[model samples]
Target: MRHGKQTPEPHEHGGDEGGVLVRGARRYEWSAAVGMLGRRRQVYDGLVALSGVRPGDRVLDIGCGTGYLTRRVARAVGPGGTVVGIDPSPSVIGYAATRAPANCTFQVAGAQALPHADAAFDAVVSSLAIHHLPADDRVTALREMRRVLRPGGRLLVADFSARPRHLRLVNLFGGMTRHARQHHPMADLADLVGRAGFAPTGSGDRWPSLHYVQARRPLEDVSAGAEASRP
Candidate 1:
């Protein structure tokens, strides 16, 4: 298996041998302060290639720890567009809340049960996350992402591949102490996206610790009523 020169930091729920999660989320400050310089470039390159977020577009950034990417998305979408960054961790959200640009906003929310309406966003993006939740939740969250997107909206997810057979196992072993769960291998990610009513945009680079899936919700039959409401 290929390994990165840079090891992922611990997730908040430290320790292994419990729930399926993998490594804990790194300290929010570390990611916000310096991680953005590199991750932001990757995100910008991917979103621009896949979603084509124009000025005035409404965007949602899930798992937006530190809101760094949210800030970048906000800048990309410009004054006309709006970007909302969401994370379940209050600490991460707190950091992001204070520093986000005027056009950006933040909320405390989980991926599976996003507190948004059908077709609420023009584009949705996530990075370095998604594997922390269970396989079922991953699918559920993807469906939620599709539900909130405008007809013809875009969904861009940048994460480590659950792909290659051995990588996931390694993550589980390495992250046990770090509190991370390993879910669907990379091969299954496409199927999950398809099951969620998304058509593949197919621009993924499975190298240098980055894996991504970009999908589009066709405008032809996007039904606002088809969205499932959460309790």
Candidate 2:
């Protein structure tokens, strides 16, 4: 059920380091795992709302495993808009591509080095994926996200933020939940987003185990605007 070429070249930025990639049959397991959380549709729909994405906005989804959230964003954007999803795993990318809506597309790339032009998207979002990134790479990935967004674009990042005791019990069984157990504190994520040059807007927790931070790229880049105007 794969689509397009088996291996499409990734973005020119090229680094594929940081974060774990889900591959093979394991990629198919996410749907069930997510269902265990209950209210799956509502949780993800809430993320779409938190993202502030509107119809006709060009959106990007980083670490878009299985395209679950990407598909939802596509619905929000409508046919006038387009959604591009990137993940480091070719397997999941292929899986996602098969089910992608006409206005959506999938690519193989990592969060730290997104394969898109600067100021290309109207909004950027990630769900339950930031925790999969290595600590050092998280900021770098956020910077990349900021770079891809147009001035005034919205940014939303959600990840597991369950208390340690709760995570410990979940991690005992291993698998994907292991990453959740080791996720960074949501405060750290807020700080990182700020450090990446986004203006903090809001943050909160979703039922089950997701924490989200919302921010906006400053409405203007004075230095960049000055440089452009000079020419």
Candidate 3:
């Protein structure tokens, strides 16, 4: 990874809520903070597995702060696959780009307004990002995710949950952390996914402090006969 290099300044993006931005040294500090939570590698790897991404799948990572999970996903996708990560802060995008693998790319964008075309990705994943969005934009972001995914594509959204009050207390220690706490429960997430036209497949909590919802875009009906056959 490149180091001691000057990075670009932060830029604005289109979204209902601008959300929190972690820039410059704060990015490194946030990385260190997440590490303190313990089992950082394993936790992130579990998210990649839960995403159900194949070797050649195209993946999109929304609100990919510092590209930590993006890099992990790059490994899962291998050399053939590509992972594009978007965040509103250009500084973090620059930071992530410097450390990005060949198969990974970073962009300045927002969760509610992705820059990709329709059905552009095979899998879409976001971690600890849903809470960062405004309450009004959360469902819009989920719909945007669904719009970018191909038919039958998988989606994994992991974020802090309402349970585990101690973890919420930990977030109060820092301004950045404060905004990262649970804004909604897993049921809310399921509701948003369903509203976005995705079929919910699973939901659960992981070790440490994370709740994830797995879903998929419904496949298009190939024919009227096929549609009628379904009970």
Q: Pairs clashing in candidate 3? A: none
- The alpha-carbon deviation from the true structure for residue 109 of candidate 3, after best TM-score superposition, in angstroms, is 0.7
RMSD (Cα, Å) for all candidates, in order, is 7.3, 5.4, 5.8
For model 2, state the Cα shift of residue 169 in Å. Answer: 7.0
Candidate 3 Cα misplacement greater than 4 A, ranges = 1-18, 21-36, 163-187, 221-231
Please give the lDDT score at residue 92 for candidate 2.
70
- lDDT at 112 for candidate 2? 79
Backbone clashes under 3 angstroms, per model = 16, 0, 0
* Per-residue lDDT of 99 in model 1: 85
Clashes of 2: 0
Candidate 3 residue lDDT tens string, 1-231 = 334655534422223346544335454446445533766788899999999998989999988878889999999999999999998876667777888999999998988767788888999999877766777787778878887888888999987665555556666566555333433354477777777678899999886557889998889712322222233
The models' CA-based lDDT, in order, is 0.65, 0.74, 0.74
Give the per-residue lDDT digits (tens) of candidate 2, residues 114-216: 7787889999999877767777777778888888889889999987676534545656566645334444455577888887778989999876667899999
TM-scores for candidates 1 onward, in order: 0.73, 0.80, 0.80
The Cα RMSD in angstroms, rounded to one decimal, for candidate 2 relative to the true structure is 5.4
| Displacement of the residue 163 alpha carbon in candidate 2, Å | 4.3
Off by over 4 Å in 1: 1-26, 29-49, 162-187, 224-231
Stretches > 4 Å off in candidate 2: 1-15, 25-35, 163-187, 222-231
C-alpha lDDT of residue 121 in model 2: 95
